[model samples]
Target: MNVSEYLLKRLKEWGLHRVYGYPGDGIGGIDLALQKAVDRGDLEYVQVRHEEMAAFMASAHAKFTGQPGLCIATSGPGAIHLLNGLYDAKMDHVGVVAIMGQQASTCIGANYQQEVDLQSLCKDLANDYVVTVSNPYQIRHAIDRAVRIARDKHVPTVVIIPNDVQIKPFKEAPNAHGFTHTGIGETTFAHVTDVAGLHEAARILNEGERVAILAGAGALNATEALLTVAETLGAGIAKALLGKAAVPDHYPFVTGSMGLLGTKPSWDMMKECDTLLMVGSAFPYSEFLPDPGKAKGVQIDIEPANMSLRYPMDVCLQGDSASVLKALLPLLKPKSNRKWRKKIENNVASWWQLLESRAMQEATPLNPQRVFWELSPRLPDNAIITADSGSVANWYARDLKFRAGMKGSLSGGLASLGAGTPYAISAKMAYPERTVIACMGDGAMQMNGINEMITISKYWKNWSNPRLIVLVLNNEDLNQVTWEERAQSGAGKTEVTQSIPDFPFAKYAELLGLRGIFVNTPDRLGAAWDEALNADRPVILEAKTDPNVPPLPPHITLAQAKAFMTSLIDEPERASTMVNSARQVLASFLPRRRD
Candidate 1:
């Protein structure tokens, strides 16, 4: 067996069934080996249009499944393209591994064509480790160590194999890394800090009347425990977007995502609470949280550095969210104050009304929010959603509600735009039995969705019931960027850089032989979604939408107001900008509760 064969064998032992990547001359040998592995029904090499998509898909796969998502790229440009997605995985704290092909070993240091010092270029991007296989015998151990580090540290890892080394014989290579291994390796990595600190945390919780819980992806597995703790403390729960699945939104005291993309009740929940408990989520937007001295904090996380840095903590507990909660529950005193919880419940209920009103409003072209309203009810209970970064993500986070079993994600920390198609494809590959949807803005769809849609067409029939849908908001603008520019500098400039031409995305999907539906009117939205949802093959639904809608921040600052006023003054088209901005803001609001 050559090094390529041994690498595949090691990956199979690591339980990787599908790897995302693009083919290239430099990595020809590895591709040949992958094709053979697929023919024998052992593994699959899902081809991608760009190397960046490979990284994004791998990152999303790791996020959805606990295992590391894998990708491969050829030398130079291909390896360089993987950096952004790799950084996305690093910032989001997901396990991802990228195997990069390098120039021939003999030509590596001679500046041979397409030769890049890949190890050094990738050193800063890799969250944990980066290694270049210098010999044939090192392949097995390198793969084993990369996989282990990815899972153990929850960070991105990279392994480079020279083109020459990939073809070397591996029959005598020692599998020393797996020498002591047993059956299937599903190692659980837990950082349990202190079991005794639960008392201190419980004491802090008991002392505060108005308590709130801020949850992130760390709380994914500890949902029941977190909810139980919330109920005991009569607390309201607000999730970081990464932790959108931490608790079901249907729970009365649970508010949706927190940050600029969050709901009003969530912002209010953070402000009104006298005490805050942060579990698993290190939400970066500390300004959106309660003032440091205003709320006494009790944070629970496996990582000690993140314990109480965001908010002042009365007690910082370091343990797994579930284990810590279980330990603390027995020592905790149950609070009966329902006032704070009731207020939170009321806000959540009203936010829905506000959301539905905006989502259902009719316009000449469709209102983009209405598309989500149409799509939400049609989603399967177990569907997995992947949203791209843009205004479409705003619609998804605000309008679309996920059920208990549903899962979804996007480029969370890095906020990369071209992730919609790649992420959706990965989700479908990971959970072929479940429905998968990629909701994206036209800018993002045009970025890489067009390329990935073709890739999906080529392999849609490979899996059992590959129920995937791509929903494009054809608004012809980088709507979120436009809104941000307006909020920052002023609105009247016309956002020259933000404007983009609309493409016939549905037609592109149809040309690739996937089912396609184009909807421009609000009346056709429900039917279009129904058609897409019922299709057996991959489908794309492109909706022509109003680009004038603004994605408003949950809380407006004085600076934002000042910028808006200045924009109106500069007024290239003051009347038009003011009217449109007002309409957008008004559409987003609901009647406030009377005190």
Candidate 2:
């Protein structure tokens, strides 16, 4: 047995059936070995165009499958390019194993071409980093440890393998069993000593004042428990975008998401609530938080570091959400405050009404909000939506409603651009029967979208389902950056540098042997969307949009507004044009009733 064969066997033991990556010289020997394994029907390699895309795809696969996804990259630049995607996986808490190829072992100190200290570079981002020793006997143990760290900690781990080691003959080690698979432990209850704190929280709830529950990604594993708590406490629930899978939108307590792109009702509920209970959520946006001086806040989290990190809590309970809720329920007295519940419920109803009204009145050049509204109803019940980091993210995070059993995933904290395409592809691969759509902006699509199309063509050609559909809003500029610049300097200039040069998106999709459609009006959008959803293969719907429109951030300072205005003050004509364009867009969406 050779070192490569031993490594492959260990990966098989780790339950990795597919590996995502591109071939490079540093890993050329291992690649050949993998090919040999493929020929022997021992493994399958899913090739990707770029290492970054490979990492993104692997992250999404790991997140959905609840297993460590593997990504391979060659030495030097290949390993370096994997950082952004790995960081995203780390922040998102998706278990991943990045197998990076290294230069020959003898070239370590010579500064050889494509030689990089990959182990050091990935140290902070990964939970574990191991450089394979030249001795083939150590290969199995190193691979085993890397897999264990990724699976147990729910974080990325790196294992750097030298090119020369691939050909070395494997020597049998005494303890070849490697690591054991461990399942998540059963939930355990924790003792709550804060009797006074529990009473105080119950009193606020029983008083009939508005109350809202905010959930985050941490609550995903405890969705049932969180939902039970919401019902028992009679508190309306609003999830952060990262926590979309925590509860379905159809749930009675579900108001919407809370953030910049969050729903108005969710934001309004946060404001109106005299008492707020944050359950496993560390929503980074302070604007959505209750002012500490005015309203009382209660937080239940497993991580102590997350507590008081965003909003200072009046009552902080450190325990798993399920454990904490079970403990707290028994200590608290049930409240029959119909008025308080009704007040918050009415606010949610009003908010939904406003959303519907807005959607009905929206017209011309097709409002992105209206498009989302139309698309949401048409989506399959088990659809999985993946959003890229850009203006579209803000809209989807707030507006898109998930049907029962439907799931959504996005790059939230590490919010890097160009995740949508790869994420969608991976989601489809993970759940082939479910509808998977990549909602992205033109700016973001240009970043990493094109590569995944090729990946699908190469690997999943015979899969007769249109598992991935990309909805590209082609506004022709980096709208988010342009908005930030305008907001800061009042300059109405569309930063040409951010613009993707001459992107023939539809033509490109067609060239890849995928269906491509260009939509201009609402009618065209509806028809094209319907076609894409039902297509037998992947499709891309490129919609030309108003570039001047901007997705507002959750919180912006008055000082920031002043700076933006200052930029506009110098160029009155350009600023006036921008303002008029915005007004027209708004006017087109304003509510109107036929006489």
Candidate 3:
């Protein structure tokens, strides 16, 4: 077998069956071997339209499956295009191994075509491990170390193989001092909880009258434990954007998402809570957290570096979230006074009501908030949801309520655009029987989602359930950044830069032989969602939404309010913008009705 074939065999032994990538002559040998692996039913190669999308798919695959995702790319430009998505994986702390082809070793130093200093380019992207294979004997160690480091450290790793080296005869390292030998064996890290640390954390939580909990992606696996601890302490849980699915939003004391796009209930809970228990989340916003001296903090995280990084903690319990919480549970005392819990539930109830009121308000065509609101109740069980970075994320964070068994994620730390479609596609590929939905804005759709629709068309026929839905908010504007400029910089929306070309997203899907559903009115949103959910094939559900609707923050600062008024001085769309913003603000004060 050739070196490329041996690499595939090694990956199969490592339990990785899928590789997301595109083809090129630089990596022709690996492509041929991939076909052999496919024919033998040893692997499945997902060919994405762009190499970047391939990397995004790999990242998403890891997030959903908890396995080391694999992506292969040809040299130079192909390697460069994978950076954005690889960085996404790196920042989010997912296991991904990127195999990049390089020019032949003989021609690499001679500056042959597609010959770039890949090691230098990938130094930061895969900081934990990056190696270029020069000899066929090194393939074993290269693949072994890359996958091991990626999976164990939760970081992206890179393995570069020269084009000529890929076709070389496979060789195992000799049992000699000069050559290094490696074996395929997975290392499992034990979760060891410190007894003193757990006792201190429990004491702080037990002593507090009003306790608040912040959950992030790290707490996803510890949902039941998190819920139990919150119940014991009478704490309200606030999820970071990355931890939206860490706890079911249907819980009474669960305050939706926290940050600029957070709900008011979360903001209020953070402000009032006297003690804080942060679990496996490094939520960046300090303003959204309680005042420094007001709350005694306790944090649980596996990484020592992440402990006390966001907020100063009195007790830092370093271990797996579930393990630490389980150990600490026995030492904690359950609170009898339920008044604090009652207030939190009330806040959450009123917040949901306000969101519905805002979503139901009239707009020129349709409100973007209403689109997500309409789908919240219609979401299928165990559905996987993805959102692209833009104004769409605002609605995604607040409007949708995730239940148990549902998996949802986006580009968290990277927060890059063009990830929604690829993430959803990856989710469906990994769990073909589960439903998947991708929410995106016009800007993100134009950026990469459109090209990936062809990808969906290519693979949808093979899915067991065939229920992927790509929902686009056709607002004709880069609404998020435009609003950011207005709210943060006190500048009016720059029409030339913010205004995007209008496209018939639904019609485009129809042309691709996929189902298309269009909604331009609030009344039709629920029906359109129903049709999309029950469609025969994959679907593109497009909503002709208004760009003027404001994505208000939980707590609007005095400066932000002044900045909005200042931007209105010369804002071209001031009339409609002001009207919509006023309506959203007024919705918060609307009377709450008992459901």
Candidate 4:
């Protein structure tokens, strides 16, 4: 057996049957091994446009499957391209493995062409574990340990394989017996609940009124328990962006999302709440939280380092979310006061009304919000939605509310662009039977997704009529950055740097031999969505949307308003944009100060 073959065999045994990467000459041996494995049906190698997309796809696959995702890249530029996607996995706390090629060991310090000090480059970004496999005997131990660390710790690990070492002949492969594999049946398991911690958390809940529940991705496993906690405490549940799936949007007393891309009821709850009970989410934005002294907090997390990292905690309950909540439910006393819940409920209802008005309004060009509004109802019950980062994310986070069975994901903490299409493709590949939709913007789609269309075209015949849609919001502007500049810098006019030339994306999809639909008016949006949903193969729907629409923060500050007004003097054509901001601010029920 050769070293490359042995490494591939070990990865297959670890349950990584699919690998995403763009091949290069440096990893010739490993590439040859992957081709043989694909022929045997032991693995599938996805050829993506850029190496970055490959890493992003691997990250998304792991997040969706709850298993470690694997992506391969050759030496130098290919390896460097993997950093952003790997960082996405590390920041979001998902398991992904990156197998990178290295220059031959013969030229250690010679600084060969495309040679980079990978160990030093990746140590800080891929912090969980980063090592190079230098010897034949070290192959099994290094690859096995990398997979194990990624799965157990839920962090990405990079394995650098030297070119000359990969082609080296070996008489025998290392045994897997001595290694600790974390497979379901082979791994030891236990349910841990902190008895004392739960008691203290309940005590804190009982003593406080106007309680608010903050949930994040950690709460995904304990939805029923989380709801029970919210109901017992008479608290409104607010989800962090990554935790949007923790509870159904229609659930009573559940404020949609928190922070800039948040619901009005959530903003109100944070400002007025007396006690905050956070679960599974280490939400980073502390400014959106209630003042420290105004509210006492109880946080539940499996990782001790995550507890109290974002907000002050009165009781830190360090344990699994589901187990701790199940044990804590019995100790809690239900609140008799419905006043707090009622007030928040009314705010949530009012917020929805405002959203409906903005989304359905008639305009010369289509309102971007309407696209999501019409698409939401058309979504399959088991659909997987992937959103890109930018102005579109605002509508995606606010407009698209999935039911219990639906799944959604994005580059959360990394907040990286160009991952939307890859994430959607990975979801479709992982769950071939379910529908997958990518809500991408023009800038993000053009960045790394334009040529990625070739991937869908080349591989479409393998699926059982997979339902995959790439809905491009073609506003011809980097709308999110433009909005940020306006909101933060008091710049009322859209800067020339943020503008992009419009492209016929629907026609671009046609050139790829996929179904394409173009909609310039709001009236045509419904039909385009329907056609895309029912298509036999992959479909792309491109809409000419309005770029002037701003994704305003939940609560507009006096300073932001002042800066906005000051900057508007530079351009007289921004009156409509100013009015839209005012409407969004008013919808949140901003209180007026008394003189």
Candidate 5:
């Protein structure tokens, strides 16, 4: 067998069945081998429109499947295109293996075309491991180490294969001075917190009058344990954006996402709490958390380096979130006074009501919040949701309610704009029987979503349950940055830089032979969602939303208020912006009027 064939066979042995990539001449050997692997039913290849989308799909595959996702790319430009998506995986701490092609080995140092130093390019993304195979025997150990390191470290790893070496005959490393042998197996982690550390954590949690729990992406698998612990302590739980699915939003004391896009109950709970229990999350914004020394903190994390990085914890336990919480449960005493939990539940109920009122407020055509608000109740069970970063994320974070058995994620750490479509596609690929939805702004759709529709057209017929839905908020503006300029930077919206050309997203989907539904009014949103969810094939549900409606923070500070007022002096849409902003702020205090 050739080296390229051996690599595919070895990946099959590692139990990886899928690969996402785009082909190029530099990687011709592997491209040829992929057909043979597919013929043998050993591996399936998904051809994406761009190498960057391939990397994003791989990252999403890892997030959805709990396995190391694999992506392949050709030399120079193709390899460079994988950087943004790979960085997204690195920042979110997901397992991914990127195989990149390089120029022929003999052409090294000759300045051959497409000969760039890939090792330096991938250094930061694959900090722990990045290797290039120079010999046929080196391929074995290189592939083994890349998969193992990525899976164990939960970070992206790189394996570079030269074009010349990829076609050479495979050979086992013999018993020689310079040869190394490797075996394939899964690494088991025995991660449990010590008894003393558990006791200390329990002690702090037991002493507090009011307790608040914060969870992140790392806590996704610890839902049952998290719920139990929150019940035992009578604590309210707050999720970071990436941990939207860590616990069900229907719980009485489960406050939704926390930070700029957070809910008011989360802000109130953190501000009033005396004890903080943070699990499997390093939610970067310290300002959103309690003031230092106001609340005693206890943290649990699998990575030793992230134990107390976010907050000054009294006891830092390094272990898996579920196991640590289970061990600490025996030591924790159940709180009999339900006062704290009751207060939290009341706040949460009020917050939800306020959100509904805001979503129902009038806009030019439709309020973006109403789109997500209407879809929240109509979501299918066991559905997977993905969102792009923009003003759309404001509605996604605050309005959509996630129930148990549902999965959701976004570009959390990197906060990239073009990930929603690829992520939803990957989710559908991984779970064909379950429905998948992608929520995007017009900016993200134009950036990458429009091209990826062809990918959907290619693969939708192969899926068992073809219920993939793409929702586009067509506001014709880069809404998030425009609001940031007004609210945070004290500058008016610059139409030259923020305005984006409008496109008929639903019409484009229909042209691709998929279902399309467009809604310009709030009254039609619920029916549009029902139609999209029940469609026989994939559908694009586009909503024409107002761009002037402000995305208000849970708590607006005096400085932010001053900046927003200053911005209105030169703001192009000052009148509409002022009217909408006032309507949103007043909606919180007044109850919704019957239509």
Candidate 6:
């Protein structure tokens, strides 16, 4: 046995069925090992153009499969290219293992070709990393530890294999036991014993007339538990964008999301609630939170550090949402509070009506709001939407209503740019039957969009099937940033100079052998969307939008306002335009009482 063979066998024992990455000279031995493993029915290698896309695919696989997904990369630039996606996986708490080939141990510090310190470079991007030594005896244990840390910590892990060591002849030892140990189950429920805190939380819930629940991504696995809890308390449920999949949109208790890009009903319900229960979410916007002095609040999270960090809490229970909810369910008395439920439902209905009315009445050349409305109906029931970080995210976050059966994914906490295309590609690969669409701004499209087209092409060539739609909102500038800049500078005074070249994004899609459509009007949007959705391969819809459009997050604090004002003093006119746009957009969402 060689080092590569031993490594491959260990991965197989750990139930790894697939690996994603691009092969290079440094990793040639490992690549051959993987190919041999595939021939032996142990693993399958998915060849991608960019190492970052491989990481992204692995992250999405882990997210969907609830296991540690694997990716491989060669030394130097190949390994470094995976940093962005690895960071995203870390931030999102996805379990993934990245294996990178390194320069031979002999030339590690000699500046040999493609020589780099992968362990040092990936330290911050991964929760745990180990550089494999030449001795094959330590391979099993190192891999076992890496897997355990990656899974238990809910973060990425990296393992570096030296080129020379991988191809070296080695013998399998008699006692080649792998790492499969689990932590003591007793420690898992330690946080549930806070009797005093639990009692206080129960008291608040019992006394409050209006209770609201805010769900986060951490509650995804415990969706049934959360729904049961919401129903027991007759509470209205509001979720962060990351929590979209946790509670289906059709759930009667759901009142949509909360924050800068939140729904009107969700925001209104939060404001009116006498008690707010935050479940597995560290929603960052303080302004959207209930007034601490007036409304009592309780937070349940697996991570203790997440509780009471964004907003003050009356009760903070550091326990898994499933475990905490299970314990709390027995203690909770069923409430028949129809008043609170009715109020939330009415607000949500009104908000939906307003949005529909606006979409129907809009007659602009390229009404983004209208385009979203048209596309929403045509989207598949199991469709997954990946929104880029910018104005497009804001639009989708604020207005794109997920149908009852649809599911979606987006970067919520550290919302990074250039994630849309890769996310969509990965989502499509993870669930072939589902329609995967990436909605991004023109600027964001230029960031990581090109590489993913190749990913789609490769997948299409192999599988003869691909269902990805890259919808580019070609506004020709960083609309969100420019709007904020202008808002601070009072509009006219702020000279927004940035402009994106009119790249043939649609033509690029055609060159990749995918359908391409360039749209500049609302009427053409529906047809374009239909054509793209019906295509066998991937498609890119480049919709030219108004560059002046701005994205305002759901909540902006007084401190943020002060900063904006300070920045605005330098460009008064631009600042005024931003303020005006914000005022108008907000006015449209705010509740109105007809006289």
Of 2 and 5, the candidate ranking higher by TM-score: 5
Off by over 4 Å in 6: 127-129, 173-200, 251-253, 358-364, 461-465, 488-497, 552-595
Give candidate 1 regions above 4 Å deviation. 171-191, 362-364, 491-495, 570-576, 587-595
Worst 10 residues of 5 by lDDT: 186-195
Each candidate: what lDDT? 0.84, 0.75, 0.93, 0.85, 0.93, 0.75
Model 3 global lDDT (CA atoms, 0 to 1): 0.93
Model 1 is weakest, by summed lDDT over 10 consecutive residues, at 175-184
Task: Give a tens-digit lDDT track for model 5, residues 1-595.
Answer: 9999999999989988899999987788899899999999999899999999999999999998889999999998999999999999999999899999999999977899999899998998999999989899999999998998898899999999999899999998899998888889977777656787788888999999899999998899999999999999999999999999999999999999999999999999999999999999989998888999999999988888887787888999988888888898989899999999999999998888899999999998999999998999999999999999988888889999999999999899999999999999999999999999999999999999999999999999999999999999999999999999999999999999999998999999999999989999888999999999999999999999999999999899999999999999999999889999999999988957445
Native RMSD of candidate 4 (Å): 3.6
The reply for model 3, stretches above 4 Å from the true place, is: 591-595
Pick the winner on TM-score between candidates 1 and 3: 3
Q: Which residue pairs clash in candidate 3?
A: none
RMSD of 2: 3.9
- What is the C-alpha lDDT profile of model 1 across 24-67, one tens digit per residue? 87787798899899898889788889999999999999989978
Give the C-alpha miss distance for residue 320 in model 5, angstroms. 0.8
lDDT of 6 by residue, 13-69 (tens): 777778889999878789889888989888878777788878877877776666788
Stretches of model 4 off by over 4 angstroms after superposition: 170-191, 572-576, 579-595
Instruction: Estimate the overall C-alpha local distance difference test score of candidate 2.
Output: 0.75
Cα-lDDT of candidate 4: 0.85
Q: What is the lDDT of residue 247 in candidate 6?
A: 81
Q: Please give the lDDT score at residue 362 for candidate 6.
A: 30
Number of clashing pairs per prediction, in order: 0, 9, 0, 0, 0, 24
